[model samples]
Target: MRNQVVSRDEWLKARVALLEEEKELTRRSDAVALRRQELPWVRIDKAYRFDTDEGAASLGDLFRGRSQLIVYHFMFGPDFTAGCPSCSAIADGFNGFAIHLAHHDVMLWAVSRAPLAKLEAYKRRMGWTFPWASSFGSDFNADFSASITEKQQREGGFEYNYRPAAPLTSRAAAGPVAEYAATTGADAATYMRERPGMSAFALEDGAVYHTYSSYSRGLDGLWGMYQWLDRAPKGRNEQGLWWRRHDEYERA
Candidate 1:
C-alpha cells in the first residue's frame, strides 16, 4: 500500500470540518429535542399487546410495573434475516444507559416485531440484559410503521439471497457492497427499516405522550462515530453470526 498520509494543513482542515459537522449535529439535536417536547400526542386508544418472559402485556404495562414507560422500537422484524446492524449497534448502547435511566424513574425496553421466541433468543445470543419483548401478532409494529408493513411483506420482504433468487443470508445482505444492506442510510428509517430506533408513548399527567423516534439515517450523528470506525482498519463486527439462522435453530 502507498503511504497516503495527510499533511499538517490537511489534518487541520479535516479536524475543522469535523468540528463544523459536530456543531451542525448539535444544532439539529437541539431542534429535535424541541420537536419532541412539541410532539402532538394522542391517547393510545387500542389494546396493543406484547409477549415477554413475564407474559402478555398491554402498551401501558411496559413501565416494568412502574408509572413511566419508555419503549424503544427496536428494528428486528419477524421475517428479517437478522437484527439491523445499526440497531444492534444502538442496542449495544442501550443496556448501559438502561441501568442509569432506571435511576430517573424511567425503564427502558427493546421491543421488536419479531416473535417473542426469536427476540428473546437473540437477546440471549447478544448477552443483553435489558428487557426485550415481541410484538409479532399485534399491529403495534405496523401502526407505527416500524419495519415492513403487511403490504410490503406481501411484496416478498427484503432479503439477501446468495443468488438474486436464493434467500439472502445475513452475511450476504450486510456486506460492504450492500452498503450495510441498509438502503435508507439511516434517514428517517422506520422499524420497517432496519436499525431504526425510537421510544413509544410516555406516561405523564395520567396520559400518554409522544417523545422521540429515529430512522436508520436520523441517528446520523449520535453514534455516528461507530459507522466511521466501521471503515477503519479494524473493521466492525456488524454482521450476524451464531443467531444468523435464528429461525432454523429450534426447528430441528
Candidate 2:
C-alpha cells in the first residue's frame, strides 16, 4: 500500500515523531548487546575439529591467534549439492566485513557439515574470501544444535532457536521448506536437518569457551540485506522467499 501523500512540512513532522521511537529502539538494542556480552560462558571440553584449507583445526584454532571467534553455522549439509540460498545471501555480507573483524582481534568463519571440497567449490563459486571450514565427520554441528540426525527428526527430539520443535513430517515437504530444499538439491527432511545459526567463542586462560549463540530469527541482525531492507521505503516488504544467492540474480 502507498503511504499517504503529504507536504514536506507534514512529512518532517511525522518523521520527527518516528525518530523518537527509533532512538528508543537504538537504546534498547544497545542494552540487549550488553546483556549478550554479560552472558555466562560455557567451557568447551570436547575437542571439536574442522577441515579447513589450512588443514584439520581444533575449535580453538578457529580463533587464528585472536581472542574471539565467531562462526556462522552455514546450512550446507553433507548431502547438499549447493549452499542454502539464504545462507549464501548472509555470507555475502560477512565476506567483506571479515577482514575488518580479523584486524580487530576477532576471527570470523563459516562452518558447515559439507565436506571441505564441497565448501571450497561453493566458496570459489560465490567468490567469498572469508574462511570456511567443514564440520564433516565431526559432532560439532550436532553438539551445537546446528545439525540434527534422522533419528532426531523422526523422534521430535530436536530444538532450534532454543525451542523444542515438532518432528519433521510431510508438512515440511511443501511450502518454503520444500522450496529451499529443492534449491539445495536435497529432500525437505535433509535440508531441514541443517539449520542456520551463529556461535561466539572466546579463547581465555588457554581454553576455549562457548560464549554465545543465536539461531533462527536471532540472526536477523547479521543478515546485511535485511538491515538495508528494513530501512528501505517499503521495509522488508517480503512475501515468501524472495532472496537468492547474490550471483543468481539476473542482470538488469
Candidate 3:
C-alpha cells in the first residue's frame, strides 16, 4: 500500500511527531535493560559438556577466560541435513561481531544438538568464522529447553519460551512449519524437536551462573536483519517464510 504523498513541510511535521514516540520507546527500552540486568542469577550445579572443534569442553570452559558468555541455541537437530534457515539468517551477522565481543571479555558461541562433523561442514559451507559447539548426546539442549523429547511432544508437557506449546498434530505439519522441515530433510515434528534461543551466563567466584535467557520473539533484537527491516520503509513487510540462507538466494 502506498503512503499519502505530502509536501516537505507536512512530512517534516509528521516525522517530528513520530520522533517523540521513538524517543519514548528508546527511554523505555533503556529502563527494561536495567531491569533485565537486575534479574537474579541461578547457579549452575550440573556439569554440562560440549564438543567443540578444539575438543571436549565444559560450560565454564566456553567462557574462555571471559567473565560473560552468550550462547545462541541454534536449531540443528541430529537428524537435520542442514541448519534451520531462520537460525542461519541470525548467525550470518555473528561472525562479524563475535570477535568484538570476545575482546570485550564476552565470548559468543552457537551451540547446537547436531554432531560436530555436521556443524563443521555447514560452517564451512556458510563461510562462518564464529565459534560453534556441538551438544550431541548432552543434556544441555534439553536442560535449556532448546530441545524436547518425543514423550514430551506426544504428551504436550514441554515448555518453550516459558509457556506450553500445543502438541504436534497433522494441522501443525502444514504451513511454514512443514515448508521449513522439508528444507531440512525432516518432518515438521522432527524439525520442531529442536528450537532456537539465546542464553547468557556469568562466571563469578569460580562458579558459573545462568543470568538470562530469551526465546521466540524475545530474540528479535538479536536478529540483525530484523533490526534493519524495522527501519525500512515498508517495515517487516513479511509474507509467510520468505527468508533463505544467504547462499540460497538466486542472483539476478
Candidate 4:
C-alpha cells in the first residue's frame, strides 16, 4: 500500500529530514570501505589454473596486467547447461561495468566451474563480452568457498563468510531455490551444488594475495538493479524469484 499523502510543505520537511540521514549513511559507508581496505591480505601460494578462451591461464594471468582483480563466482556448474539466473542478473550489471573497471587499472572476470565450451556458448547467448573463465578442474572456486559438492555439502566442513554454512540436504526444496534450479537444466540437487560469491585479489611482486571476498547478502551493493530498486516507488517489492535474464523478459 502507498504511504500516507501529505501536504507539499509537509513532504518537503520530511524529504529534507531524510536527506540528513542519507548523508550520515554515506559518511558511515565511507568509513566501512576504508576499514575493509585496511584488512589483512593472505598470500595465495597454490598453482591455481583456469581454462580461458586463450588457453590455460594462471590466477595471476587473470589480472590482465592490472594490479587488482575482481572475480565474480558465477554459479555455472559443470552439469549446468546454462548459467544461474540470479547470477546472470548480477552479471547483467557487471557486463556494463567490467569494461569501465578494466580501463581503471582493475580487471573483472566471471569464474565458473563449468567447462570453457559451456561458458563460451552461454556467454554468446547472453551477449556478454566480460571476461569469463572456466575453473572446471581447478580448486580456485573451492578454495574461495564458491563451489561445493554434494559430499562437502553433506559433511559440512567448509566455511562461508568465515562462518559455518548450513549443511545441504538432498531434497526437493521449494521457492526461489527450486525455481532457479530448474532454469539451469540440472536437478535441484545438482543445482544446489554451487553457490555464488565474489573474491578480490591483489597482484604485487609476482604474487597474488587474497584481499577480500563477499557472499550472500553482503553482495547487495554490487547488484546495480537492486540499488536502483531500493530507490524506486515500490522498493524491490519482491515476492519471490521474479527476475530473469534480460532476454527472458517479455516485451511490452
Candidate 5:
C-alpha cells in the first residue's frame, strides 16, 4: 500500500514471525471460548412467545427440535418499514451457514420486535432463508436487552453488554445512526429503540436456560463478512458505516 518493495527473503522472514503471534492468539481464543462455555446458566421461567411464520410459538418452541438455540437480535422495531441495513448485512452471512449449524444441533433464528409481516416481507426482499421470528407484543426483546422504551431511553435504567450504556442523547447522532434510521423509514428516536445483540439458550428436560448474550462490539465475531475482511490485505479498511444490504449494492 505504501508502494514499498521488499526482497523475498525479508518478506518470508517477517511472515514467519507474524505466524507465531497468530498461533499464540489462536490458543488464547480457544481458552476464552472454554471459559465462556463454563459460565453459569440461568433458568428462564417467563413464558415468552414469538410470532413466526409457523404461527405463535413459545420460547421452547423456538428450539425447533434442537437442543441449542442462538437468537440474533436484529434491529427492526415495530415502527420501521424495513430492517436495519447494517443488521441486514450481517444476516447476509447467516443463510448459508445456519443450515450447517442446524445439522450440528444448533438452531439459529433472527428475532426482531417488528411485526411478523414486516419481517417476512424483508426476508423475502433479501432472499434470506434462515428462520426469523417477531417478538411483537411480547416482553422477549425487553427481557433480552434488545429493545428499550422511550421511558428507559429518557430516564435511564437499562444495561447493554453487561454495563450501563451511555444515555441516548450522548450517542453520536450524525452518521450511521441517522443514515440507517432513515433507511428503516423511522425517526432516529424510534429507530434507536432497537439494538443489535445475540442470545444463546439451551433446552434440557423441557426447560430453556439462558446460556449467553452479547451486545455492542461483543458481536464482532458473529459478523461473518468482517471475519473475512479482517484477514484481507487491507484488513477491514472501514470509514464510517460503508456497508449495505447485499441487494442494495450499486451495479457498476
Candidate 6:
C-alpha cells in the first residue's frame, strides 16, 4: 500500500483560501450590524399597565429598579385555566436565566394578562420564580396584538385570540389556546368583549409608553431551533423530547 502525502505549499494555499472566506463573512456581519443602528424607533402610544404581587404598576415599574426591561409576553392569557407547555418549557429556561439578566441594566420578567392570582398560582406550580406580572383589565395586551378586545373581536379579532378548537387534536394544542389573552372554559367566548389585559399607563416628560407587554414564539430563539429541526434528516430530536410528564418515565 502506498501513502499519499500533500506538499506544504498545498496546505498553506488551502488555509489562506479558508481565511479569506472567513474574513468576507465577518465583513458582511459587520455591515448588517450597522443597519441595526439605523432601524427606526417607534414611540409607543397609549398606557400599558401590569398588576404585580406588590400592587399595580406601569411599564417603568417592570424595570425592577433597572433601566431596560425585557418582558416575555407569555401565552397564558387571563382566561385560560393553564399555561402553555412549550412556553412553560421556555419559562423553565428563564427560571434560570433571570438571575443572570438582572446582573446587567436589564430586568427580564414574564408578563401575562392573566389575573394576578392565576399568574402567581401557575408560577408556583412550575416551581419558577422568574417574576411574572399581570396585565388583567388592560388594553395593553390587545394593543400589542397579543390578545383581542370585544370591539376588536366583534370586528373580527377573535381569530387572534386562543382558539382551542383550531387545533387538529385536543391534547396537543389545548395548552396553547389557554395562554395569555386566550379564553378558558367560557372566557374564550367573551375574551374580545372585555378589556381582558393591558390596563394602565405611565407618564414621562411628554409622552405615554406602552409598558412592555409581550408576545411569544419570538421572545426566545426556541422557535427557530424547532423550525430547523423540522428539516433535519433525523426526524426527531431526542434531547428535546425527554419531557415525559413523569408518567411515561414510570411506565418505562
Best by lDDT: 3
List where candidate 1 sits over 4 angstroms from the true fold: 1-28, 65-68, 79-82, 153-195, 221-252
What TM-score fits each model? 0.63, 0.97, 0.98, 0.96, 0.96, 0.59
For every model in order, what is the number of clashing pairs? 14, 0, 0, 0, 0, 17
**How would you encode candidate 1's per-residue C-alpha lDDT over 56-76 as one tens digit per residue?**
987777776555566667777
- Candidate 4 Cα misplacement greater than 4 A, ranges: 170-172
Q: What's the lDDT of the predicted structure labeled candidate 5?
A: 0.91
State the displacement of the C-alpha of residue 119, model 6, in Å, after optimal TM-score superposition: 0.7
In candidate 3, where is summed lDDT lowest over 10 consecutive residues? 243-252
Q: Higher-TM-score candidate among 3 and 5?
A: 3
| Order of models, best TM-score first | 3, 2, 5, 4, 1, 6
Every candidate's CA RMSD: 8.5, 1.3, 1.1, 1.6, 1.4, 8.3
- Determine which window of 10 residues in candidate 2 has minimal summed lDDT: 243-252
Give all candidates' CA lDDT scores: 0.63, 0.93, 0.95, 0.90, 0.91, 0.57
Q: Could you give candidate 2's per-residue lDDT for residues 43-150 as a string of tens digits?
A: 999998999999999999999999999999999999999999999989998877899999999999999999999999999999989999999999999888999999
Per-residue lDDT, model 4, residue 185, is 95
Model 5, C-alpha of 250: deviation from truth (Å) = 1.5
Residue 160 displacement in candidate 1 (angstroms): 20
Task: Report the C-alpha lDDT of model 3 over 54-114, residue by residue, as the tens digit.
Answer: 9999999999999999999999999999999999999999999999999999999999999
Query: Candidate 3: misplaced stretches above 4 Å?
Result: none
lDDT of 6 by residue, 1-252 (tens): 243467999878887998898899889879975774455444565566888978888777777776555666566665667665445655666766678978966677777777999889877766888788888888766555666554554445243333321312334334433232242333434432322222122335544444433233334343334545555756345643343212224765
Score candidate 1 by TM-score against the native.
0.63
Evaluation by lDDT, superior candidate among 2 and 6: 2
Clash pairs for candidate 3: none
The TM-score of predicted model 5 comes to 0.96
